[model samples]
Target: MTCSEKMGSFYSGITCQDIPPHVMKKARLTLFDFLCVLRLGAKYTVINPIIKRYLVSLEHPEKYTVLGLKMKSSLEHAVLGMSVVSHGVELDDGHLSSATHPAVAVIPAALAMAEKCHSNLRDLLVSIVVGYDCMIRFAKAINPKHLSLGFHSTSTCGTLGAACAAGWLLGLDSEQLSHALGIAALQSAGLQEMLHENASIKPFQVGKSSSAGIIAAELAALGSKSPSKVFEGQYGWFNAMSNNDYRETDLWDRLGKHWMIMDTYVKLYPSCRYAHAAIDSALELYDEGYRMSNVKNVKLYLFQQGINEVGVFKVPSQYEDALFSVAYSIAIAFQYGKVRIEEIASNLQNTRILEFADNIDIISDKQMTDSFPREAGSRIIFEDDNGNIVVRENKRARADFDTPLTDEEYLLKAAQILENVVHRKYIDVLWEKVVLSDQKMDVKEIIELMNEMGA
Candidate 1:
């Protein structure tokens, strides 16, 4: 069987009962995080303008609900608008091995379809899990190399993965699911060039991928036919985009045995995953009695993949670019002992962050290449003013840990996001729908809940 066949078979055979309890728990946790982020994302100073443009330009009647907004939008526009904001804030969940943000793209696409089809939350959970599995596996299989080839795996693989989830929710048969995958595969495109400097196109990649998934699935349901060899055929995703050979079967073999949804991690900082290890290590150094003043110079030894993505834009010339900078993240984390959204905004070009960030050098480490994509390891060498040197390594990145967030942590994240914009009632409704419930949810009601207090 080809990749799509194997995937379609799994989608057809898998049921909510077949998902393990732990995987279900992670799925819910992932959803909770996505909801919290979107609540804050819709109001971002940068993204809100883009939202208004679409709202004004399209101005269509309500078909699906856009989170944190009163106006309803058509399904594709709704998915596109919500996904752009969801990931625009840069606090969304990601699978480290494949380096894809599955939840941001997959969840929005799934929710839009659910609202349109009147599907329940139980089925929504199934679709999300299946999407994560397909996306992360494909990403992990080809990336680092896929990234070196200049393709953003998140958007490229994301289109296909979200299609799986969307197709499943729309009740596409095995053949139709494969057809949807083929349609999405052809639409896949996202470049790392957006990471260069303050480009607003970053979140649009996820938005387009999510919207493409729904559109592809809809087209497939309307009798679209495509090749089963879409993933590995001549001039297929692997042959055309990958810089190295990718074998998808082994990753697929571990699918049911290992849930990729569980492997995906949440970010404590709203920066690129490439810079996460350095942030974690810098925070630890501060805790170990090493202040920014105590440090003379800092050097980061990252894998080639990390260096390629984040090293070029070392010191962010603009606010949004800070999310993709190693120096900026390390400097901010070391300066304030934490990285926050407000700091990135208010202190985008703060002299302190710039001074520290300028002294930091990011060098590509060839030796560490083997541990990348799968492990996301990094080494930090610190030189203090007193001539005392500290070398620290973050091997088991904080983002990919096995434990889920506690109840307090979950609520705190939500409250932090909902701090200045919405009322307590907004959070109350959000918490109930995302954290406290497990029954079949009418997705439209979920949208209504967001607008309870006129969000």
Candidate 2:
């Protein structure tokens, strides 16, 4: 069988009953995280309002509701808008192995499709599991190389994931799902160049992939044919995208037995995943009584990839720059001993953060570079005016599977995002509905609950 066929056959057969209880639990957690980030992004981020207004101006058929907003639009546009909003703040769930954000890409497409089809909660959960599997497997198979080649796998591999979820919701069989994957492969696109340019439209690229995935699945359901060997053909995705630098084992190893959603992570900070380890390490130094006023110089050591990405931004003027800047995050961690949305937003004009950011130097360490994609480690050196230095290093960030957040931690995070934006009652109800309840529920109920919120 071709790559897409094998993946489709395995994933299309995964019903809610077949999914293990643990995997379902992880799916709920990620779903809750997605909704929380979606709300925060819509209300807090500047880009979401502009995108919503543009979509509203288009005046497409108001068949679907955009979460955290009072507007409704067509299915594709609604998913597009919501996907952008979900990733707007960079606090959405991500996978280290693939170096991609799956929930932001997959959940919005799946949720919109589920609402359009009135799918049951069980099926929605199953689709989410399979979607994460497809997206992470494809990216893990081809990346570090795929990512090094300047492609944004969240939009590239994420298109296939979104297609599978939407196709499953539409009741597509294995064959149709394979066709959808093939169609999505042709539509997959995004770049890492935006990071260099400091563009805020990075989230828009993610949203376009979600929209493309939905279109691909709809076309496949209508009998549109596509190449079955879309992943392995001579001119297929692997060769064309990964330059043939990929691992076959990463694609199919323990496919049905090991769920990729279990390997995913939820973020506590609204910054690039690469910068989290450094922030954590810096916070540790702060705990040891190293205030910004006492520190004379700072040095941060990170993987070459991390340095290549986050280390580029020394000073941040806007949201995108601040989210991707390791120096700014470290400065925030030292200056405030915390990095939250309000802290980051309010400190952009603070001369202290800017000065501390300027004094911090980022270095690429070979040891850290080799440990990447498994553990995003960092080492920090702080030197005081008296010539005394303190160093701290973290092998990994705090929110990985080994150091997973507690149920209470997840709830606290959700409450922080939903506070003052939605009623406290709605937040509790959403938590119960998504993470606690298993009763027969239509996806539209979730949509209606979210519609009560607005930016």
Residue-wise C-alpha lDDT for candidate 1, range 1-455, written one tens digit per residue: 88778777777677788899788878878887887787667766366576757775887877788775556788888888778878877888887767788987899888888888888778888889998887888788886678777888889988887898889888998888888988998899999888875566788888899899889899999999778888788878778778437766546666687788887788777777877888899889888878778887788999888887767767787767777778888887777887777777667758887888888878777767787766666888978887988899986567464755676787776777667767777777776876568648766666777666444
**Colliding pairs, model 1:** none
Candidate 2 on 1-455: residue-level lDDT in tens? 98889877877777767789988888888887888788888877667778878998997999887775567899889889889888878898899979899998899899989988888777888889888899999999998899899999899988999999999889899988989999999998999998887558899899999889999899999999789788899999999889999999998899888988899888989889888988888888889788888887688899998987898878888877788888998889888888887777778888888888988888889988988788888998878768998788888888987678999999988887566577778778888888888636887777776766553
The local distance difference test score of each candidate is 0.79, 0.86
Worst 10 residues of 1 by lDDT: 243-252
Candidate 1 achieves a global lDDT of 0.79
Cα lDDT for residue 100, candidate 2: 91
Q: What's each prediction's TM-score?
A: 0.93, 0.97
Question: What local lDDT does model 1 show for residue 145?
Answer: 72
**Number of the top-ranking candidate, with lDDT as the measure:** 2
Instruction: Please list the residue runs of candidate 2 whose C-alpha ends up more than 4 Å from where it truly belongs after superposition.
Output: none
